[model samples]
Target chain A: MAVASAVAYRPPRLARKRTRQAVLVWCFLAPSLAIFLLYRIIPLLWNVVLSFADWAPLRTIRWAGLDQYEEMLHDDVFWEALWNTLLFIASAPVGIVIALGLALLVSSEIRGRDVYRTIIFISYPLMTVAVAIIWRWLFDERVGLINYVARSLHLVDRPIQFLNSFVWALPSVIVANIWQMLGFYMIILLTGLQNIPPNLYEAAAIDGANARRRFWRITLPLLKPSLFLCIVIGMLNSFTSFDLVYVMTGGGPGRATELLVTYIYKLGFSQTRFDYAAAVTIVFFALLVAIAWMANRLSGGNAGAVETD
Target chain B: MHRYPRWPIHLVLVGVSFLMLIPFYWVLKTSVTGENIFAYPPSILPKSPHPFYYVDVWYYIPFARYFANSVAVSMIAVIANVVLNAMAGYALTRDFPAKAFVLLLFLSCMMVPFQATIIPAYLITGRLGLLDSYLGLALPQFSTIVCIFVFKASFDAVPRSLIDAARIDGLAEWRIVWKVMLPLAKGAIATNVILAFIWSWNNFLWPLIVTRSADMQTLPLGLARFLSYQEDTTGALYAFCIMVLAPGILLFLLAQKEFIRGLTSGATKG
Candidate 1:
């Protein structure tokens, strides 16, 4: 009805050219709209439907109602994964703080800012599979760099199994994730920092404010938007924690690092329980929607913070 | 010479940079040396550089096949992202009824994570008989909301006079977009291409679900299989890592400034 109202009052004389322009517009929009429908919107709706149905390899699909959600409630692994997913969300600020620190440093004129920026930002572009592979090697028990340094410094009698230990698995992956992501946050934050009006800082300095005072009084308040953007983007990124968790531990050492997406993969593909996984997907989808709604509020209705590559 | 003390800042930045480059240096060093990678007191430097592992990785596994698949998929994704996204973006820029609705649709699509969409995406791809096909792997990635916005932002930047002048000269709407606008938006296009390449090449989950045959696996999937199957061999894994990671890194390096500008413009303009 709203759309009908929008195009209803096309004046008859200008209708032809308007129609021409409209045809051209849709001609351009066809491919993307089709993709959006087929790949995104349809799949999302299908996920919602599939959650309420059960699938068996040889047997026919049957309506399971909330059976899958019931199973999810009883599953201990599901609870653990839920906990780990929250942990992953909580881990966002670790990377953000580090990135803010690095961004603050690099945004200033110390020296070799370009080199620092390039090297720091390099990891963001590398494949997580490769980075995870390297980190695996680094965290190896025997001659891995972490072990080597620990042993040399007499910090331990043995190399800690960083990826293998349940206690350390999430933290280890979190460290690698932060290492990979800090640069991206730094770059984003650096841009935000550069956008701050210099006069604000200049006036603060001229009024006998110290460097610390200037940062708190001038920089911190202004930098809140960028910081908030990083927080939300980082949390959104934490949702798709499949690749690193897969390569690093395979969500392993007994499902210690199992993120929800990884658990969904395990259920759907590994166990052939698509219905249960679909339920998990729906639940998480709702959670993310709530988070995205909050992100909209945080960004003051500019929700582009959630729309990243 | 700076206002703040330079020494402390330089020291901190250099230290952090080194920490950041640790994984790259370790991978490169291990792949080259072929020495006891797990030996205690890990060699800080390569004693004997052995580049043969790169060759060994190819013969041991079908690295060439995976590399080729990745290349083809990434290239197709890049081209499609550039062209189709630019079209949708251009269309959104026009003063048409329901423009806000269409734009909202795109943004909402962006919010839906692929984890939710993967099950049905697999089903649809299976229905199309595209499972294990390159087109199937590359198809869903063709258009992203980010790319559309990039192009729209670029199109918005093209001065109204330039587009109007092209209109006066009898160019069609798309021709105006193509001839008058796209050239000016090469920075956006380049960023889109690089980002699309990285996303496609690094994508492991969808391919893992879609691909059954070993030969059809992309490089990331292949490396993962190697890590799981040949868990003892570190050198070949490093070699594969170096090979798979280099292209994306080099592409980013080549287009660093444009990429940063494109990113920040989307960021600030938002």
Candidate 2:
């Protein structure tokens, strides 16, 4: 009877150990996972659910399936917002180009590269909104530094209203966006550059390939993964850019700078049209997924292009 | 290529970096100019740099309080995020029932841009009555998928033998993680903490939505409202803008090495 009791006690101890492991794992994951679900995932799911229902704070709720979607189809503001979003996202290529340029320039065996890298990379960690405000000052109509420098050098005839005027606002935002992002993609591309063995570049040089040709062949092919990542992330960031545009322009000059996210914020928060806002978010989600997929597809094949071209 | 001096590369990079600093310089100049911003031609360099604007910004807007709030929220959030993320990441890499599924869930969450969920998040916070509190501001940021992803890779590089030895000695799973894994992953932990700190400090949207009162405002939001209230670039207010960004810039300078590493290393790895 004593032996039986001891054997039973050993099984319970094993069970106790397993239970302890399970509890420990959950404790480790709970804080982050709970916050993630409460803030991010729950909101995401609720956003979808909210798309089908009409509700406002301090009012009765009614579920109207697909009505919000139907309204969005004919909403001119929606289309205008979509156009503005495309305009902003068009800045992605500029980011890629600047990133590529920085990557190429810094990859060279040069003095002070680390200092340059640090300076540019410094901007990446700073608040984007702060960066935007600084850009706003630089683009101020009367006393902006850009105008002072350009006009002093006889580059332009007038002090452009970079933030207010229609012609300059989009481009101004795009340029600022590019400036803020250039270092980020550059760092990523530099990493990719580092991963490429020096022997390959050496072998290409031995084959009598010139600098431009070698870059096109060797560097471009090797750097495709990072380039692809930069492009995808750039696209997403541009598509969803809020802070810079919010502070610099406020989608101003009569909604000229309104992107999808800004538009959604206005619809839901300012106007209290929760249902319609949810619809806009759903569409933006689809656009993001599609664009991401397309980018992946295009980037995947570029490796082949790198070889063939 | 050799025709262009290597100096040109340095010249261009240094030149661009100078361009980057121009706005920061302007912030300093404007804040101290002690003149109305609406003057016909704004002075590029303030004739006199006054320290009074910083004082004025602080007095007029509860700048000190908001600065404290921002610091408290960000520091707590960063510490919590680093610790929790490292543990979850270590476990996911080491022991779990459905490891791949859990990781994939996190990855997909990463892809779900915050724009898609800000409203519902706002609602949930409101429901929980967490609005206008530091916990409200910091809690959402505490669960960053990026940190988890970075820490997981760092922990993967830890030797399995450490865990095995600890188990042989009958150290519990939690202690093995706390004692064995954490000391070894210091670089990654520092990277995550600093990155999280910067992000939390710089965050605008969550704080904007959740914290309604000026008393509850973080530094960035407070500075923004102060700027908007000024409506034009006055010398003193401009100085305030520069002052607002000083801490962040200083932190960046101090941890520039980790900042660059975190930014570059995380992007490529994931």
Candidate 3:
């Protein structure tokens, strides 16, 4: 009986070691798994559940089953918000072009390229709200720098209300958005520029390719991955355009600057119509996911950082 | 390309840099000037620098409280992020049957945009009875998926021989992780801490919704409130923007290299 007990107690050494490793793995994984499950995974599932139920008034609690979505279909504000979001995405190419220009300038045989890189990238690191406020001050009709400069330079006869007018509001926001983001785009493109072999450019020179031709043929094609990266990032940043619009215009002078995210925030928090808000959230998320999926497919999966946005 | 002088490129770069600094200059100029902001031909320099607005901001609004709230939230998030991400990251690099699945889960979670999760997350905070608390605000940002990948990459670069040697020397797994693995991951850790701090400190949406009381507001919330509350107090508004923006800008300037590395390297790797 004693010998049998000793044999049982001294389990296989390899098996015991394996068990210890498994325990260690679990120990390491538990915290991250718990946090992600509670904060991210569970909430994502619950968002879908919340979308179908009417919990706005507790006494009228019941599953609506697409009623909220139906409400969105009739809501003009919803369509306006969707259109505005698309416009925001459309405005990204402007920033990307400016960024590419800046990247090219710095990547050349510039004397102060490093200094230019640092200075140009400064705004990306600052608080979004702060950056927005600076632009807001600059947009001030009475004493704004932009208006002052424009008026003095005889460019415009009058002080334009950049954020107040419906026509100018969206474009104004886009310009500010582009300025803050140019540095990020420039740096990423700069990395891509560095990776291109100097020999290719030199060989192109030997083939009598002029600067403009070289840019169109060699530089542009070789910079595809970086260009794709900028496009995706620009799209992502534009759609998530809350902090800037929130500070600069608060989604208007009207619904001019209203974005999908801001509209959802207003519906849920301000109006307390959470049921309707959840439905909007679901639809908006689906659109963004679809865009991401399409982008991934079109890029042939070579462009990584699908969610760095 | 060598046929032309590089001075033209240098000139263009300088011109752009100056354009970039213009807004920052205006903010500084406006915040300091005591003169009417609406004055035609706005002065580039402050007429008489209103240094008092900086001090008066604390009394005008609960600036100190909001600053404290930001610091507390950021620090808590950073600590939680470091520990949880390191454990998960280290374990991920080691031999494990469920490794691929765990990583796939992490990557999937990474793709979950904040806008999508925020609505249900708000409800979750309410259910947990943490809606009005600091923990509720910081909880979502406690550990990021990106930071975990950062640590995993960092650990993968650390030779496996060290871990085996530590095990052979009778070092406990916890000790090996704490002493051996962590010290080597200083760069990644620093990157995560700074990024977490900036994200939490600059966070507006979650803080705006979760905190019901006036005093619980973070810097961004407080600044937004301050901006709207006194419509004509342009100096005060600019002053507040400067105050709110200074710390983040200063931190980035001081650690520019680390930030650029973290921003570019971790981003590309993930």
Candidate 4:
């Protein structure tokens, strides 16, 4: 209806051209629309339907009608996973601060800045599985370098047991996650930093402003849109994080690290409770929607001012 | 002499960069180190740099096959996405009925997580007899929402006058998009191509689920198999890590410009 109303008031000569354009547009959109609907959208709707029924892959789906949702409301594990997901999101500010700090440091007229940027960004392309695998080895109890170094420096009495311990496992994973994500965000934030006209800083210096004051007043406001974008994407990505947890801890140590997405996987695949998993997934989807909507409302969803890759 | 002496800043930047590069260094060091990786005071540099670990990984594991499979799958998937998304992006942005409906459809696809469809996708693949095959891997990614979004943004950037002029000529719609639009959008196309390739190459979960046989595994799945070997051969594990990382890292190095450009393209809108 919006598009129809949009095209309704065109001139006659433009009308024929517009019709042709319309046909061309559909021809372009068909394949992608088909695939997205089939693989992504339909499955989402199917998951919603499955949530209301006792759907299992091997057995006939029986309508449960909000029983799963009700169960989720009472489940302690559900609450735990929710809190962990929030914890993970909370962890992202560390990465943001690190990224912004690096971007600020490297964005200056430092010699070899390009080399530094390239080396830092190099890890972004390495497969996440390889990173997780190697990091796991590094976090190993007996042989891991982190514990060895810490012990050597008299930082701890014994090995830290990074992954095995319930208390340390999530934080350890969070550190690795931040490491992997920092380069990408730094590069992103650097671009925004560089976009600020150099003249502004020069003028500020001429007016006797200190570096700290210049950064706080001039740089921070100009970089708000990018910072806001980074926050939203970082939060969303952390909330739905699965690969790191799957590869590192497998949500082990008695489900201490089980995120909502990971929980959805366990319930559906491991427990064979598809309907319940579907309900969980539906709620998870709602959470994502709510978060994105909240961010948009906060920022006014101005694609021109703030967007994320 | 001290006009531009920000040496301390440089020192700090280099320090952080070294911190960034440590993991890659460890990967290289561990792959070549002798059988003492688990020893205390880990070797800063391997005393005896053994190159045979690479050869051993190829011989002892099906890594060669996995590498080839990854290359094939990533290439096919990237190509399919590039072509399909270019068309879809052009249509949705430039012309067509129900334009708002189409755009909303694309946007909503981004909202749906793949975890919801993993089982159904497996069932579909099974029904289509696509299990443990290349099609099962490549087909799903071809309809990627991210690529469509990228291409649509690029197509939107194309000047309206040029498109109108082409239409004024005797050019067909397909010819206009193919000849006129695509040729003008090489930078964006290259950006999407590299991104799509990197993503497809790194994908582990789908391949792990779909492929049943060892021979059909991609590099990620192959590395997982290598890690699960229980051999405790640290050198071999490092060698496997290097193999898994080498291609993606090398590609990233080569396409660093595009990688950064593509990543920041959306970011700067803020």
Candidate 5:
């Protein structure tokens, strides 16, 4: 009887202890989970639902069923914004290339490399809005430094209206974007460069691999994960660059710089087109997920930079 | 190892660094010298720099109020991030049911960039009646996935024997995290604090959407409004920009090692 009683006691107590741990782990997780659910997951699902309904603040939401997407089909601004966003994504490789060069330079044994890295990275951590302001002034048409230098050096006939011109506005914003992002890319690539086994280069040297051949064969392939990471970040920047475009040009001078994010903001807050904005949001989210998926595939099914598991 | 001349590398890096730094120099030059857009031949150096423009910025707007608002919001975010992320990260280190699912959830949440969620985030914040308030401004950024991972990496590096010893001493799970774990996770905590502070400080859009009242505006919004209001007429706008950027730059300069580590933590681990 005593043995049976002890056995009975042991199972329940063990089960209770397991239950207690599960509860404790969950309790620890509760706050962060609550915040993410409220801010990220719920809002994401709600955005999807809102896209399908004609709703505004304080108005009853009514199901519209593909109407918003249909409107998006004909909306020229939507197309332009989408095109501009893709252009931004396309420009990512340009920044990455330059950053790669900078990374290689700094990663080598050189004087004042840390200082150079610090100076290059300083611009990145500045407020984007403030950076926009600074760039706007730099690109100012009349007394702008760029114009002054151009006029002095005979680079152009007149001060180019960088932010005001349709052709120049998008590229100008892209330049600013690249400038701010270059440091971050360099750092990531620098880390990648540092991780490469020196013995691989040594092996290549013994094989009579020239510097260029060694770089092409050894350095580039090993840097795939980091390169892919930069590409992903660059893609993500298109959506996240709202503040830069918003403050610099406000998607103005004929929507030349109108990114999807700025367009969505304008539609929802400025124009009170919540339903349509939600639709754009869904499309934007889908684009990002697609990019991530493609990036994952491109990295041979393990996007190490973004690996979840 | 092959040796190469260093001058060319220095030359190129110096030129690139100059390009990277020119904008900041230009802004600082304008702010102090009160150079307007019409200042021709754009002086290579400041003719006369002064602090009056900063004073003008201070007087032109409610700079103090905006500064206070920014500090409060960043404080809430940094403190909450360090505490909550430490707990969540500690929880992640332990074996538990659905651990994989939780991590996947966190990863997916990261992909849902905050910019894409603005419309509904605003609506939800409105529902919670937190708009135009400090909590509303800081709520969305209270916990970030990367910082959580930073804490996890730091905690994972802590020796398992120490935790076991703590457990043997009859320490509770929370107590283990507090007494045994946190003492060793100072680097992660610093990373979290700096990253959280910078993100909260530099945030523009959320505050733009959430804050309706002028008084509720943060430094970024204030600087934006000031830009529009003044339109670069005086040096005050640039002064405001400098003032707005100073804290972030200062913090970055002070703790750049940790800042860079926090950013590159996940990338390097992979």
Candidate 6:
């Protein structure tokens, strides 16, 4: 009986050790988990609930089922903003294509490639507000560099009001957005380029494939993951570029430059319509999740940085 | 391999680089020269460049106060990121119950962009009584999911034998993290520090939403306000832009390798 009791005690001690480890792991994870819970998980759930209610900071709360969404359906500004958001996203591939070209160029064996890469990448890390300011001045009609050059070259007889014109506001803003994000796309593609095994290119060469053929066959196929990443990131950027739009044109001359994010901001804080803003938030969130899901599926379920396992 | 002439590539790259950098150069030229936008044939070079505009920006609109606010908030964010992310990352390396659930939670949290959460985030901050404070500005960014994974990747690379040796030596789990794991994860530390500082320093929306008082506004807010108030009439605003951009540029130039590495690793593993 004593021997049996000793063996039983050994099993209990093992269980205690396992429990101690589990406790330690939880302790280690607590602070970060707490932060995400408060800021991310809670806010997300709150946004969903808030979307279904008529609530503000100081007002009585009431159930307003589908009212905000109904209003959004009829709102021209909302439709315009949504359309502009899609346009902004549509413009992403333009930047990605340019970035891919830059990536291919920079990755080639050339003198001063690193310097060129650094200079190109330098713009990305600066504050977006400052970038917007710089671009705003550059597009200034009176003394802007772009106008100065355009006039000197006789591209236009008169200075164009790039940010103030309804026709040019969206495109001008898109150019600024692309300039800021170009370096980031280049870097991502550069990393992807580096990761491709050189032997494939060598084998293609041995098969008499031309440079263009090699790119179309091997480089393009292998670069799909990076391209998908750029696309998703580009979509995310268009959604979050509130500072740029707010500072550059304030979503004007009218609603031409208004994005969904800027609209949500105006509704919530500027107009104090938190309930309506919550609805917009839900729609925007849904759009992002759907885009992410589609990217995951399109990338064959291995979209970088998104896997849940 | 066919060796192509490099000059065309260099020429193309140089042209691209010029396009990328002309904005900074133009801004700098304006800031220093204070040239009037109305002037015909703007001087190709900054004629008689002076430091007066920079001085003007310094005294113009509580620049020092905004600078201090940015620094303090960024410091809190950077410290919290390193500590919290390291602990969380180290914990992830060990097998435990519900580990998969936790990873899934973090991944989903990453999808919730901060822009999408501003409404509730603001209300939550108000409830916590942190609104109009530095903590509110820094709290949302305290533990970036990407940085957590950065630490995880780095710690996962540390040989298991070393951790086992520490365990056999009777070192507690937390001590092993502090003494053994951190020492071997210097690159990850650099990545976290630079990324955290950049994100916190450049954060505009949160500061704009959270701070009601003028004194609590950050550099980005200050620059934006200065732009709205003065419009493009003054070089001081351009000077302010340069002042706001300097730290981030300097940090990037100083540790660009680590910065790029951090971004690439995060993106690839993300």
Most accurate candidate by lDDT: 6
Docking class of 5: medium
lDDT of 2 by residue, B50-104 (tens): 6887777766777779789989999889988998889777766756576667776
Q: Candidate 5: misplaced stretches above 4 Å?
A: A1-11, A306-309
DockQ of every predicted complex = 0.66, 0.51, 0.60, 0.57, 0.77, 0.74
Pairs that clash in candidate 1: B32-B50
Candidate 2 overall lDDT versus native: 0.79
- Chain B alone, TM-score, model 5: 0.97
- Across A1-309, the per-residue lDDT of candidate 6 in tens digits comes to 999988777757788889999999999899999999999999999999999999988889999999999999999999999999989988999999999999999999888899999999999999999999999989998899999999999999999999999999999999999999999999999999998999999999889999999999999998887898898889899888899999999999999999999999999999999999999999999998998888889788766664333
User: Sorted by DockQ, highest first, which candidate order results?
Assistant: 5, 6, 1, 3, 4, 2
> Model 6 over residues B1-270: C-alpha lDDT tens digits?
656677889889999999999999999999998885658778889999998999998778999999999999999999998899988988888899899999999988888899999999999999999999999899998898888888888898899999999999999887898899999999999999999999999889999999999989999999999988988988999999998898889999999998888778745653
**How do the predictions measure up, each by TM-score?**
0.95, 0.93, 0.94, 0.91, 0.97, 0.97
* Over 4 Å off, model 4: A1-18, A206-208, A300-309, B1-5, B123-129, B231-233
Off by over 4 Å in 1: A1-13, A295-309
lDDT per residue as tens, model 3, B1-270: 577877777787888899999998888887777464768888877786768777778779988898999898888888888888888888887787877788778877866778767777887789899987888888888788777877878888888788889989999888998889999999989988888888888888889889999978999998888888886455878888889888988998888777776666633534
Across residues B180-259, which tens digit of lDDT does each residue of candidate 4 receive? 88988897789889988988998877897788988789998887777776434558778888878887888888989987
* lDDT (C-alpha) at residue A180 in model 6: 97
Candidate 3, TM-score vs. the true structure? 0.94
A112 Cα displacement, candidate 5 (Å): 0.7
User: Model 1, B66-133: lDDT tens per residue?
Assistant: 88888888888888888898998888788888887887788788788877788788888988999998
| CAPRI-style class, candidate 3 | medium
Instruction: Going through the candidates in order, state the TM-score of chain A alone for each one.
Output: 0.91, 0.88, 0.90, 0.89, 0.95, 0.94
Worst ten-residue run, lDDT, model 2 chain B? B34-43
**Which candidate leads in DockQ?**
5
What 10-residue stretch in candidate 1 chain B is worst by lDDT? B261-270
